[model samples]
Target: MRIARMHLNESPFKPSRLVSSHVSKYVDKLNLYHVEELEAEFLKKLSSYTKLPRESISLYPGSSEALIALVRFCRSRALKLVSIWPSFHGFVEFANMEGVGVDFVYLTPESFELDLAKLTAVGSRSKALYLANPNNPTSNILFQDKDTLDFLSSRFGLVIVDEAYFEFSGYTAADGVLDYDNLVVVRTFSKAFSLAGARVGYVLTNQELSEEIGRYTALFSVSTTSLASALGALEDIDYMMEIVKKVIELREELKRDVEKLGLYALNSKTNFLFIKTPTLGRVLARSLSEKGIKIRAYNDRLIENYIRVSVSSREDNLRFTEALAALLRERSTVG
Candidate 1:
């Protein structure tokens, strides 16, 4: 049986050869903590890759860790949070752990796009506004320019933009950090670089904010091998880009195929496609799972009958599309 794992939204590809090669060099250092010098060198490499100043970057074991740390930092200040409904749930989950609540602004019912006006209203009163570019679950983007820039420039508290899908979407607010003191952009090497297991991610903000968040990161949160793997992934940028390009191509094709099934797929800029499945969501998911294919299915009130599918290799996607078409056809026949 063939399995298609699309629920986690990770690339089906392996990390670059450089990652394996460099990680092997650190095999003997497994017992040692990630040294300060090694951490500094990794920061420099990340700085070069992201075109941000060295002082602005802070590392974590993963973006999830960085998000939890930031949430804790904000919660300490007695700040309320604002975020979109059905967005990435990591920060929200952490905020709850910190005894903080989120004021959620739901996206438009049809397009799944952010309501900038409503967001501005809620965000202005909150302590921090959190967003995921090429947002999770929906896989749609909030405009990076006009409205988003205006929000970042406002006194609407600290704005946290999770750009974990930046390499896939090609739109980012990282450069906005130079202009907005309250803006914090987070990224990871997990998706495009195929380094999910390495668990290396970074935060980009000004010196003051970076220092503030850095306090929450435990000493040596990122392992020596993880740092080395991240550095190696950075060095192999072209290889990652090639994979990203292929994923984008496959993503578009998958979207088209999904739409042909009479379901609504958001115009996604990320590596995944979110289809509004409505009434048959559970049935469709069960059918696909029985076929050895897996994808995320939502049963929540706000996003009921929804599925998020990660764009995989051509062969995997073809198999999924075929399986999906079969399911829909079966439904039609039974009806």
Candidate 2:
């Protein structure tokens, strides 16, 4: 019984050959504390890939670290954190742990759209806003309108946009980094690049803010091997794009299949789907796990019936759909 691991939104494919070969060259260098030259080259490649100045970018072991750094910075400044409910829970949990006040604006239950007006009213110049563009668990882009984004960017003291799924969504606030000094766009190699294990991520912001945030991050936070992996991934953009194409295709196919089975599937811009299950999500998740398939189940009261599943290989997708159909049929018969 092979488990279909579709819980974390990880790439179904492996990293490109370039990533493996590049990382191999650095394996023997692990004895050293720092590899300055390799780090510089990685930053150079990253700056070029992002089309932002080198001073505008800062690397971290993972985007989660970068986010934690931001939360700490906010705490230092006495700035409260504002975000939508049922988003990347880790960040919210971290904020609470750090004693940073947080205010959440729930998305409309029907469409999963942000009520920007409510967000604007709740957030103020004294607070910082953190948004995951293609929101987690919902799989939809919440900040589609640039005017609304600009309004919020100006309204808030600091705005952090988590573009972890940027490659799949094909939308980013990276350019806004130039226009708004207070804007920070965080990205990762964990998703589309298939380098989740490498734990490489970066932040794009104005030079001034980048430097300010740099003060809070530890020196040489990203290791030599992780830097090599990220650099190789950037050098081979075509391979990453190919993976994204296949994942997007399969994601749509899976959504249609699930819909045909009478479950509601939300249109996704990322590699996962947010499905409204016919029963408790935890129960469905438990049944699927027992059958060697796994997915993310929400415990939040607002969306306890929703499950998030990653797009995997065709075979795995079929297995999931089949298991789901059997479970639904069994429930129907028992009812």
For each candidate in turn, the TM-score is 0.95, 0.97
Which residue segments of model 1 deviate by more than 4 Å?
A: none
The worst-scoring run of ten residues by lDDT in candidate 2 lies at 93-102
lDDT tens digits, residue span 1-335, model 1: 97888878898889999988888888787888756666777788888888999999989989999999998888876667878777997778888887778878888887778786776566553568788987998898877685666655584678888999999889888887887888899999899999999999899999899999989879888889998898888889999999999889899998888888787898888889988874656678888899888988766777767888999888888888899888777777887
lDDT of 2 at 244: 98
lDDT of 2 by residue, 1-335 (tens): 78898999999999999998898999999999799888888889888889998999999889988998899888877788998876899789878877776788888876888887788678788899888989897999987667867887888999999999999999888878888878999999999999999999899999988888877779988989899899889899999999999999999999999999989988899999999997999999999999999999988888898999999999999999999999999999999
- Of candidate 1, the 10-residue stretch with the lowest lDDT total is 146-155
Model 2 ranges off by over 4 Å: none
